[model samples]
Target: MRLELSTMRRVQRNPPCDHIIRLFEWFYTEDQVILIMERPPNSVTLFEFIKHSKGHPTERAAKVIVRQIIVALHHCNVCGVHHNHTHLRNILINRDTLQLKLIDFGGARLIAETPSEERTLGAVSRETAVRSGCECLYRVLCALIKGIPFWIRLSRECTDLLQELKNDRTWNTLENILDHAWFKEASTVNRGERN
Candidate 1:
């Protein structure tokens, strides 16, 4: 079995975390490997979720979802799994419950051994792994809040944080991301609500 699948299996065996979708079963075949994953009910892609909300969902809603995303990535960091593909479409949100599930490990990697810098894939160090994950997280958050991609008028804190992420001013690691002031923004009102 590949590191990706084995890592997934290890995660599934550990304590349950709602942030990540569970992988029920997996087995290798001569040609291809088969993986059976859990499908969260009443869930839609974050892309669809944003579309239904019309551009951007309330900052509070986005914060909640983004926090969940951070938690999921943090979980991956602890498990030594790097989800290189952290895009809007890769996350699923329950329409009613507002729960989130980070899905699609197709581009995921296990951070067991340090690959040569020449290897063009997941980050090498744990910090860099989570940092890379956060990089993608911010990109997705940008699209989620901006309603398009690489854009936002959401909030000053959010704008600053996004800029810092791009500029590498802050740690850019997932832990620092969770501790960011923007991430701590309380859900008070939906400034971007539109009808």
Candidate 2:
């Protein structure tokens, strides 16, 4: 498990996301692996924040958090990595600035050209159907927009994106996805609705 975590962490470092904690260093001791990670002051988990506030967050706050999460996911997918365990609990917020950061990549997997036949729930194999970057982007875009749970979402997206990537030559980039008109419209709509 520790080895898996370390691999995921390494993969995460390749394409760092502003919404993710920066992993600075790692070392192995006699019995434990020391992962030196950035420590954000006044940070709290999204679950904690929601709990303290009771149920959902304020509309303004939720929008901010959600946007940050989507940005993080976009980066991960674009980097050919899948963070298969994203949820409120995995999100951390800096209380002072209300900035969001994603934590825990234990479930992350590198996207590979050949999809592995090894099958298991919550397990990722390298074999993906999509062979093109654009198709992968489109699949990831759809997943982000849908707000699907991380575990089930990645597998589905991987299969779909692999197909799309093979067939489509054009795919949206993270910046474009973030700046898409649909997202802007959704943000506007969400902003208007109070928790």
Candidate 3:
């Protein structure tokens, strides 16, 4: 099945999560397919958001943004989908609510459809596919956090984890990195605070 079709199927089956872009409906004919989605009046792509900021997101903001992205990826994994493209351009943020929405599932693939080599441990699991996606995100986040094109002058925690991500032999999952001392410590402190 087409990636969009599979994505629609998985999304519709799951309970709504604010971090995922809502697909209202779709139309298909011999020539074209149309996806009607929810778009807030004032919103911009994450790329534009970052570019306009003209500065890196703070540690606090980065944590929140990363957490939301992780949540969205988790939902996709639970529904058996993998968002192959997890970059800034495909993500949107509501200017007012500051809510994140993952869009453009054209690159998304069902976990079951992925080639065996791409799957972690040569087996399919919700965590593996989603964590694989996180590999992309980790790089981006590190770059943003350090305001550099490469992971240089980053915190010790980020540097160590980034090394793990780069090591093919390393089995560190995205969930494992998220629960690392860096992010977990932040979560513990912000548990009761509201955005």
List the global CA lDDT of all models: 0.73, 0.55, 0.66
lDDT of 2 by residue, 7-53 (tens): 45654665567887777877878887777778888888866665565
The alpha-carbon lDDT assigned to residue 163 of candidate 1 equals 87
- State model 2's lDDT: 0.55
Clashing pairs in 1: none
Q: Select the stronger candidate by lDDT from 1 and 2.
A: 1
lDDT of 3 by residue, 30-89 (tens): 887878888865889877877776534555566667777877877777677787788888
By lDDT, who's the top model here?
A: 1
lDDT of 1 at 110: 68
TM-score of each model, paired residue for residue = 0.80, 0.59, 0.74
Error of 2 at 177 (Å): 5.7
The residue ranges of model 3 lying beyond 4 angstroms of the native Cα positions read 54-56, 113-128, 148-160, 168-173, 185-195
Q: On a 0 to 1 TM-score scale, where does candidate 2 land against the true structure?
A: 0.59
lDDT score of residue 12 within candidate 3: 61
What TM-score should be assigned to candidate 3? 0.74
Error of 1 at 85 (Å): 1.4
Cα RMSD for predicted model 1:
4.0
